[model samples]
Target: MAYVINDDCIACGSCLDECPTEAIAEGDIYTIDADACTDCGTCADVCPTDAIHPA
Candidate 1:
């Protein structure tokens, strides 16, 4: 499964840099592109507010 960015996202850009596949996009709360996500969990690991999770 891909990782999903929840509403708790602060849009701090922390996960953006951590995504190896560049699946994350900038937005009001940020968004993870399911098709591009590698399910590596890197984004979730770097999320400051624990917003990213398996979808």
Candidate 2:
């Protein structure tokens, strides 16, 4: 399972650095690249808005 950024995302960059695979990318709301995401949930732990979730 990969993690995804939800609409609740505030466009913060916290998750970007937390992603070990560098899967999170800047966007209208940050996005997690499913192919690169490893279900580590690092981004979720670092998310200020709790917007990162399993997809």
Write one digit per residue (lDDT tens) for candidate 2, span 21-50.
Answer: 898889888888899889998889988899
With a 3 Å backbone cut-off (N, CA, C), the pairs that clash in candidate 1 are none
Each candidate's clash count: 0, 0
Q: Candidate 2: TM-score? A: 0.93
* Cα lDDT tens digits for candidate 1, 1-55: 9999899999999888889899988989899899999899999988889999999
Candidate 1 Cα errors over 4 Å, as ranges: none
Error of 2 at 38 (Å): 0.5
lDDT of 2 at 42: 83
Among the numbered candidates, top TM-score falls to 1
